[model samples]
Target: MQFNVHIGAGAVLASALAAVGVWHAYSSGWLTPAKPRAGLAINERPPEFIPTNGGVLTIAWVKAYETFEKRSPSELELKVPLGTVKVPLPFGETVSEVRTAAKYQYQVRLQKRWPIQCGDTQCVVRTGPVELAEPVAIYHGETERKTRSGWARFDKAANLEQLNRSLGLALVVRGNEPRNRDVGMREGRVEIEKFVREWMAKEAHGARRIVVLYPGEQMVDGRPVPAH
Candidate 1:
């Protein structure tokens, strides 16, 4: 016995069309390209965490000269917003406020540290770096700040002015994405929060992280919480 197998012209044409569509999509980066994904987690038996000494931290945002150059954040930068600031004494020991700027370079005034009596001749009152609760978003331009009519800045300024002596926090700006800056700030804030949570989990310090996001302008734990 002999058997014959045949395929319909319609079926062959449909397959060919599907194959071409896929090829076109792949070449156009619709199917072939993959977006970069970020993952966050705590490590087991992580190294000892050291806090940056000082009651104040200065944040500066500079434009990137080369797009290809990798960003090398300092130890303070990596461990911040999650790391504690080593403050001394009962006088102005708490963090008062956190600030950020889009200017190329700027200086911040931190509280003066206690006097360290060196030898017998002179006593030195030195100020060190302040621990950051979160990494500041330094956009290439003031696109977000300007577009929002400095709404984010206004929030920060208000929060800092009414800041309490107990808790310190970095504001996470979220809400509508009318532009690119809005989206950038939102994503950056998410990453910063993730980094802090990961550190709290991995570091062996046995510390708990508490985050409160307010929908509007409201105070939580003595700090102003901004919402979307």
Candidate 2:
């Protein structure tokens, strides 16, 4: 018996092989995927985009200060280091301005003789609310820049007033750290997670997405979709 092979059979086989080769190239990173098209579906006027405000949260390293005791005129004062603190921000609030609120350390030094009732004869010296240098911007993201100073004057139009009353989210200051890798820093993170978990439990606001913004690489529980 003579078998008849169609001429298109060879062409079909070649087409199948070409498709497989293209797929292999894609799998092997030799081929890059096309970028998604931006804009509205169908005939659109101005693109109407609703801001979901998916709870944009930011954590920032605030100010650090030192305390010391000035003894006599000849005696030098010993300074004690105060670790850096993380100041929280109001939820859904975009900071329009950042200004520092002054907090000062005062020391009373002995000037003239006092009565026996006063244990230490000292002049009650009133010092300044000495302003510290502005904190250097660490995480340079859009939200990070706005929230850098920790204390922010949120935009009035952000509708924070309504959100604040509904959300009941307040900026909380946790532990103090001398540096990012400080032992207290880890402890602070733990505490922050605990706080977040507790806060989540209290919310009956249905399912919501939590997006954490960090400076460097982080180990997430599952495979994370890269934002970049």
Candidate 3:
């Protein structure tokens, strides 16, 4: 009987010790479920969304073909007090012509300050002046030259050579002219509008309708018009 009682007491003591150990572990947090790692939690917050504003935009080279022609004087003239006297030259007149293809680049300075107005679903953005991104590029490989010399001309070859040498420089000068720049800008206007529309759609703060205006243009009757 005593042996059985002792056995029962031993079992009771063992159960109590195990219960105490379990309580201690619970209090120490060793038995609690592990906390999620820093970024591995199922309920982690996401980053905030931000929209992008456009930067500088550039158009690739636009191709243009032009013909330049020059005619040299047939005779030398001597200036006098009252009038000029013409003296026939040994070499007659030389007419030289060159046909060349040039490439021009256009750019929009979006990074600069530009006016912007927004309505409920529409936005109007005034862009900077459309400008040349680089000097005109002439394709020499495609240059075509024609020279015609009069019957007595001896320097036809030399005249043609001089024209050829100055062709590139002359074309560059012509391309920089105001009228030529206007033509180039007009040529690229459609593409520039399309590009701006697409870009504004992405960056104009949920604007569904985008209107772009270049320099020297104004909003007229809800449309764009060239400023006088």
Candidate 4:
């Protein structure tokens, strides 16, 4: 009995060591880059969602860059709206309202975060660098601000201005695409709702996200959920 107990303990200890070894291997990214990695392929594409009543919502991603490198998001560019809307971000509110091409509506601002650790997982995610997506845009204004940078004057005046804040026209959203009298647009509404749910699950509080609602593409006079 004593001998058997000793053997069992030894086996269990060995198994645990093996398991820990495997976990560390995974988390530390020891088994990656089996193939030569030239570099990470960085792609930034906006995800679009179509809803009922001939409307579409596009979730464009914005990335922070050297003040000049990425001035505004190209994917979802917004022309200056006629009026600037000042919606409130009530204390402890995940959703807020702003002027659309039309009126006021609620949009949930969410943030996603990933710990930058070793180089392997870093390479995969940084390839796309999703966590940094935001409302990036270039806007036209009255004048440019001149500032000294590394012994040089730079022209910098690109931001969406609100009552007290400088906000960018971050996202482009439209209603259903023009209905082709030929091909019927499929109902992808259920799929879209699922996506938002998943994004919410991953997004934490106080994180801001941009949503654009499209209203007029499918219908003759579709009213879009304007993202101001």
Best by lDDT: 3
Over the full model, what C-alpha lDDT does candidate 2 score relative to the true structure?
0.31
Off by over 4 Å in 1: 1-178, 205-228
Q: Please rank every candidate by lDDT, starting with the best.
A: 3, 1, 2, 4
Model 3 TM-score, 2 decimals:
0.56
The per-residue C-alpha lDDT of model 1 at residue 137 equals 39
Displacement of the residue 132 alpha carbon in candidate 2, Å? 11
Error of 1 at 34 (Å): 57
Clashes of each: 3, 0, 0, 13
lDDT of 2 at 172: 18
Residues 1-228, model 2: lDDT tens digits: 999967788899999999999999999999988754531123333311222234322222343322111111112223434567545333332323222221211111211321111012111111112122222222212221112111242344343333333221111111122332233333334443343444445643223332221233222442222234
Q: Which 10-residue window of candidate 2 scores lowest in summed lDDT?
A: 114-123
lDDT, model 4: 0.29
TM-score of each: 0.19, 0.24, 0.56, 0.15
Cα lDDT of model 3 by residue, 39-87, tens digit: 1224544322223355656644566788888788767533434446544
lDDT of 3 at 1: 38
Ranking by TM-score: 3, 2, 1, 4
Give the lDDT of residue 124 in candidate 3: 61
